[model samples]
Target: MLKDEVLKILLSSGSHVSGQDISNKLGVSRTAVWKAVTALKNDGYDIESVNNKGYLLTKNKSILNEAEIETCMHLYDCKVFPKILYFNSIDSTNTYAKKAADLIPSDFLVVADTQTLGRGRLGRSWSSPSSTGIYMSLCIRPNISLEKASMITLITAMAICDAIEELYNISPLIKWPNDIVINSKKICGILTEMSCDMDGIKYIISGVGINVYDTEFPDDIKDTASSLLLETGTKTDRAKIISSAIYHFYEDLDTFMQTEDMSILKSKYESRLANIGREVMILDPKGEYPATALGIDETGALIVNANGKIKRIISGEVSVRGIYGYT
Candidate 1:
């Protein structure tokens, strides 16, 4: 109890504390206190000491290791994705999942504390640092079609956001097609990659990255990035959020499969739309267009109000960046 207080005080302030002060309050000898403080320093805490002064915390970064995340798991079905492959460093969770799914059991979860080659939709680079995020991928192989696989992406996005909403009570808006934004900045990014044969399907791997605790974003994305910590002004438990995300994901995926109708998912999706009814610019290989957002249709297609007529846009080289730029 006293050791924790001594460490907490040293961590909370930049100024040096004294060994005498720690011993006086904790009722422990200076040597016993020194051992405890030294132990915390060895555990990656940047504690500095002077001749008289006790310790001063210079920095504390999240060691986004797997033990902490696994400690956060609350799913009653512990067998479901129980084995998490935690990597200190990895190229990409999705790429690794794709390669590993051939032999690994279904529903195996792979989480990386840091990703060197993280990827986003449209081959964009996903910025993932060790400190403020979760980079996890799950391997799933369902007896579904190559064409109907869009539901997997939609359902997964909804599940992740819904779980966050349930746990943190901070609702994030969906940037239709994929991605979740809070305060007009991206908070979560989803990448769904699958290997399917012409006759049937092989496996589907879904990668999810959520920025939970962050002090800053990359300079290139500073204007367009955010984190749960930045949004709520409080530190969040990463394990709790990740467990909640997976649990909600399983529930929503089951419901989506049972219905076999995207209309049901579409309705629930609209309630969390970030670009609905907003002026937008489309960045596609076909150039660009001016359109008003009409929310997504049942097929997970973006409906655009172009020239007062609704155009149902299916798969194309499309990028919906908001014209008004407000989420």
Candidate 2:
């Protein structure tokens, strides 16, 4: 508790302050200050405890850390609760938040360290490994119409691209409808679900999962799924990555609010879509011929210029695997 209070003070200042100063400010003993620093470090905060000067929070070694996230999000007006409903492991953040959608605030974040049964676009299982990724969901209730609702996924994908490029210096390509691929391997996925009533929309839970720290993936996805640690050969801070996501989430949300049309987020989305302009094949169950990868449409539909005609993909039932990259 003292650590939480101290972290609040330090994070607010955003600069280095002496230990004696922190002790004097908090009205606690110097020994107590030292104790709090150790506790915080044990809790995964990468703090530099100097001999006489003070503690320097080098990094937030995140886990199910709510307070750490709040520190980074001190500038948002949405009043995100970084310290609420955190779990080390759970079934699904989206499923958990959907059950309590009506009860929680609009921007409430439900994050888990690992999800035993995480889900994707369809009923596909989302693999969430422990301490290696960010498995989280946010509940949002927008005033947009149903027709415009389809654009939220595109907006989110663009935001994901921004965060990835900003934080990792990697430009992961966006697979239309919400997938991020790096080196032709999937490093991220977004799962958006909604709950509605006859009156109007209740809320939508946007769940995101990213592979962060594994050098090798499960056998089934060994050739497909990859992580930042695998690609970069270094373990990335999960909290900073989450902060990156939130920071852009706010910016993209602001853009969405201003435009109120998903069209605004399209260009950026297409720029990162690795499938754009590449020769590709679509696995359509209707026994249809394969389509060529043209680009994504405004509504985040995968536009495949097939046989002198253009086909817009709006659903995930059709599989679009790269002919050259993915085997």
Candidate 3:
């Protein structure tokens, strides 16, 4: 924890931070500060310590950790996520979040560098190689009904798009209900799970898996899936993206919770929707149908024109896809 505190000071200082200043601020000994810096360096952080100058955290393509993420949260002045729980590797952030749901507070984040058992929507495996992706889950307890909970996934997709657009300067698109894509290739997936009883809603675990640095994919998904590096030809800081996503979620969540519907947020979401104005095939359990995506309505349903007839497809009810291939 002292290392994290030292990291925050170094990051925000933007220059060398004196050991004495860190000790005074954190109410610890200078020896403790020196030890913290050493720990950070051991953890793969690029830190510089000169004879006169204190410590400087030079930017590098290091792995995701709690200190960097918390520093980003502080730099961005984000409020919703007060606590961040990070893991080097895990079975799945979603599974961990759910298991520890009652223990953790609302807006607590669970992030991992790699997932041994990563998952996606419709029972698909998400590729989660080491140092190649961001796997995180946000835990929240909103006082809304179960019916309105599905919209959280859409809101998360929009938040991720906000992060990508701002950080990478790339215009990301939402593939219908729960996917983020660039150049028509998916770079992220979202799975939102809710728990509740007759009383009210308990909590929602919004799991997001983002392909950050991967340049290649499996043979089966090479044609459809992509990463930020593949899309932008540049390496990205995973912590900043995570911080931005959390910030944007709180930004849009206020407007959404006010109405408990997508009416207020539908316009913004539709503008970045990849399925809008496109012909997509809906894979329903009953059967498949071809339709032109009109956009989402106030209730977060996909509005489509099916053979001159209008129909609204609910989230989790069906999978929408481009007629030619995955979007």
TM-score ranking, best first: 3, 2, 1
- The residue-by-residue lDDT of candidate 3 on 1-327, one tens digit each, is 888888888878888888999999999999999999999888888888877788888865556889889888876756576579999999999989999898876568899999999988777887889888999999999899888888999999999999999999989999889888898888999999878987767999999999999988999889999999988997878998999999999888888988999999999999998988889999998999999999999999999999999999997788898875465
Give the per-residue lDDT digits (tens) of candidate 1, residues 22-126. 778778898987887887767677777878656776765454445445545643344355466878789999999999988876577788877999998878898
Q: What is the lDDT of residue 159 in candidate 3?
A: 94
Collision pairs in model 1: 17-54
Q: Give the TM-score of candidate 1.
A: 0.77
List where candidate 1 sits over 4 angstroms from the true fold. Answer: 1-68, 76-82
Decoy 2 TM-score against native: 0.86
What total of clashing residue pairs does each candidate reach?
1, 2, 0
Candidate 3 contains a number of clashing pairs equal to 0
Instruction: Write down the lDDT of every candidate, Cα atoms only.
Output: 0.76, 0.74, 0.88
Clashing pairs in 3: none
Candidate 1 Cα deviation (angstroms), residue 78: 7.9
Please report, as a residue range, the 10-residue window in candidate 2 with the lowest summed lDDT.
Answer: 75-84
Give candidates' CA RMSD values in order: 8.2, 3.0, 1.3
Model 3: per-residue Cα lDDT at residue 292: 97
Expressed as tens digits, the lDDT of each residue in 229-267 for candidate 2 is 787676656766777777777677777767776567667
